[model samples]
Target: MELFFKYLQYEKRFSPHTITSYQTDLCQFQEYLKEVYDLEDISQADHAIIRSWVVTLVQKDLDSRTIHRKIASLRSFFRFLVQQGKLERNPTLRIKAPKLAKKLPAFIEEDAFTQLLDQSEFSADYKGFRERLILELLYGTGMRLAELTNLKLADIHLASSTLKVLGKGNKERILPLNTSLATSLSQYLVKRQEAFPNNNSPFLFVTDKEAPLYPKYVYRVVKKYMSSVSTAVKNSPHVLRHSFATHLLNRGADLGAIKDLLGHASLAATQVYTHNSIEKLKAVFEKAHPKA
Candidate 1:
């Protein structure tokens, strides 16, 4: 376990959240091994035993994505063990991850998004302004919830209309802001200073008590406002992110640029939005075709 964690920290350069996920997956696998085979060391595990574990996971009715993640974790762990000379060969080499259908992400329409923003509950009060800013920034920048929550005051450059965000794997990227978003952010900064006064919290968004906003607070705020806006789609920050990307794609934005703006590690990850755009085009064609 220590070796795996050290490998994650050094070789893979995974972030704390990703490292934590790997640790959790390994811990769960270890617990399963203990209960079923009374095995403590992964190196002692064999191919048949690993196959049986996969069967058990299937029998337990875990989702395809969850099963895939477990397989990934096991593969990484055993490959590391083999590299360290603890194992003769990797047994998980033949284990196949469950096939999963690609489900297109749900996104809010442009009109619905505009309506939500127009009707959002905003006030001159510090918390109100802070929440409003959070909403604006999420939609405007398409930043991940964790990225937004971890934002530091120094990361924002109002003069340049750009924000430096530290994304997954500790990779940093510069995300640009629009005029409206920059204005909203500036106003919020002024309100934040007045509300917090002498307090020195470096985070961009904070609570009423002047502490940094937690993930749950952000989720609740999104859920509360999104519930009023639309029941057609699930209410989450990620949905807003999807809306942001989809809207950009529908408007003919370049795929490469969108990938960079969203801080995706690869173009393949960003290409999923193209599926949503195609579906929209198909709908329009079906409605407008004279032959139909």
Candidate 2:
């Protein structure tokens, strides 16, 4: 297990959070093995034992997705053990993961998004402008909260109207900023300087003490503003990102372009937003058609 985690961290370059989740899932699997089979090492794992574990997981009322992830983790772990000569054959090779239904992404409506931004009160104060800018950038650029929180002053290219975002796997992508969002960012930067004149945190967003903005703070700011606009959907930063992608697809933006803008590795990841747009179009057509 330690070897597998080291491989994930050093070779696969998994994020800290992802590594932690992998650790948790594997630990749970290990505990089950200890209790059920008295197995203490990967070399003793076999197909029959793994299948019984799957049955046990199902009996525990775990969701299909959770069960699927555990299976995937075990499969990878067994493969690693095989490669390391701990096992002669990988038993999980024939094991299948449970099929999961594709759930549609949640998004804010277009009008509600506009109202949310317009209704957000921003004072001349540094924190107010800074918070507003954070929200604006999330919706405007469709960046993930981790990407936004990790942004540095050097990442912003105001003259080019682009932001250098370091996404998952330490991949860097340049995302463009529109006129309005760029302008708002400029104003907020000035206010930020005034608020923390002597501070040198380099991060674009900072706290009251001029420390770098944490993910929790960004989540709270998004929730606070979104709660004022609508209570239908859960207010969160990712919702703003979904709103950004949905609105873009609604406006006829190309899927490939949207994929690049959102820093997705594959077009399939970007295709989910089309489902939201299609649902919206269906509603509009149903309302307007005479032969309903």
Candidate 3:
């Protein structure tokens, strides 16, 4: 397990959070095997044993998505074992997880976001400027939370109206910003400079003390403002990302363009947003097609 985590950290370049999740999933499975089947060695576990674990997980009331991820962690670990000659065949090779119902991603209406920005009262201080810019960057660029979090001072090119983003797996992409977003960011930079003249933090978004923003800080900031404009079931940075993609698609942006803007490697990931578009189309057809 230690060696696998080392490989994930050094070779796979996976984030500490992702590595920790894989560790947690593996440990839970190991404990289940020990308690239920008295199986100490994971290598000795067979397909039937794995299926029984799946049944137990289902009985424990875990959602299908989570159970699928746990199984995926197991599959990857067993594949590693097979490569290392510890196991002759992967026990999870034929094991299948339950199918999950597709759920469309939720996004705040563009008008709501505009109202939140234009009419809402935010402190006229550097801190408020910084917080507002965070929302604009995520919604305007369609970049992931991690990409926005790791944004470097040099990555923003105001003159070009573009932002260079380092996405999943260290892949970098340049996102062209709208005029409003560019202007907002430019103004925020001036406020930040005046407030923290001696700031040395390389991150784009920082706390009031000029410290780099942490994940929870980002989440809380997003949730507080988003909750005011939207009663969304889930309010986080990703909701802004979904708003970016969904709004673009609704306005007739090409699917491929949205995919590139979101920095998604495969079209499959980007197609999830299309489901939102399809629902709108269905509504229009139902209301206007006269077939109803």
Candidate 4:
């Protein structure tokens, strides 16, 4: 298992978050096998055992997407073992994941976001500036939460109005900064320097204590601010990202251009936003069209 983890880390170049998720899924599966079947060796599990585990997950009412990811983790692990000659056949080869329903990504409306950014009052100091910049960067660039947390001061190119983000698989993408976002970033940098003149953290955003930003901290910050303007069930950082792409698509930006900005690996991922656009169009037609 350690060898497989190392392979995922070094050879596959999976991000720490992804590697951690794989580890968690495997551990949970192992624990389940141990408790249910008294099976000590995961490599000894057959297709029946794997399917049973999937059934147990379904019975537990776990989300289908989560169950799918767990099965994927098992499939990858078993395949690796087979390639290494430790197993003659893969246990998960016949295993099937639950089908996922087509669900549109939830996003904050443009008006709500605009009101959140413009009308909501942040403190008139370092904390306020940092909070504002966090919202701006997430919506402005559509970067993932991990990418935002990993952002470095050197990644910001003020002169060119660009941000270099290290995304999944360590792929780097440059996102253009709009003038308003750029000015906000410039102002935030000065405030950051003023707040921490002696501290020299390399991250673009940091905690109030001059330390690097963490996922939970960012989530809390986003939730706190987003709640004031949005009634959406989810007001996480990813909603800001969804808002970014949806707003762009609503404004008639090209799909390929959106894919590039969002750092998506393929067009399929970016195409989801089009569903939101279609919904908007349907609303317009229903309201404005003469033939009802």
Question: Whole-model Cα lDDT per candidate?
Answer: 0.87, 0.86, 0.88, 0.93
RMSD of each: 1.6, 2.1, 1.7, 0.9
- Cα deviation of 149, candidate 1, in Å: 1.1
lDDT of model 1, residue 198: 89
What TM-score fits each model? 0.95, 0.91, 0.93, 0.98
Predicted structure with the largest TM-score when compared to the true one: 4
Please give the clash total of every predicted structure, in order: 0, 0, 0, 0
lDDT of 4 by residue, 1-292 (tens): 9999999999999999999999999999899889999999899788888899899999999999999999999999999999999999887887878999788999988888788887889997999998899999999899999999999999999999999999988899999999999999999999998989997889998888888989998899899999999888988999999999999999999999999999899999999999999999999999999995
- The residue-by-residue lDDT of candidate 2 on 79-185, one tens digit each, is 88889988888898888767787878787878987797787777768888988898889999999988999999999999999989998888899999999999998
In Å, residue 9's CA in model 2 sits off its true spot by: 2.5
Error of 1 at 176 (Å): 1.1
lDDT of 3 by residue, 184-217 (tens): 9899889989998999888888887777888888
Ordering by lDDT:
4, 3, 1, 2
Question: lDDT of model 1 at residue 104?
Answer: 91
lDDT of model 1 at residue 278?
96
Q: Considering only N, C-alpha and C atoms within 3 Å, which residue pairs clash in candidate 1?
A: none
| lDDT comparing candidate 1 with the true structure | 0.87
Residue 116 CA displacement from its true place in model 3, Å: 1.5
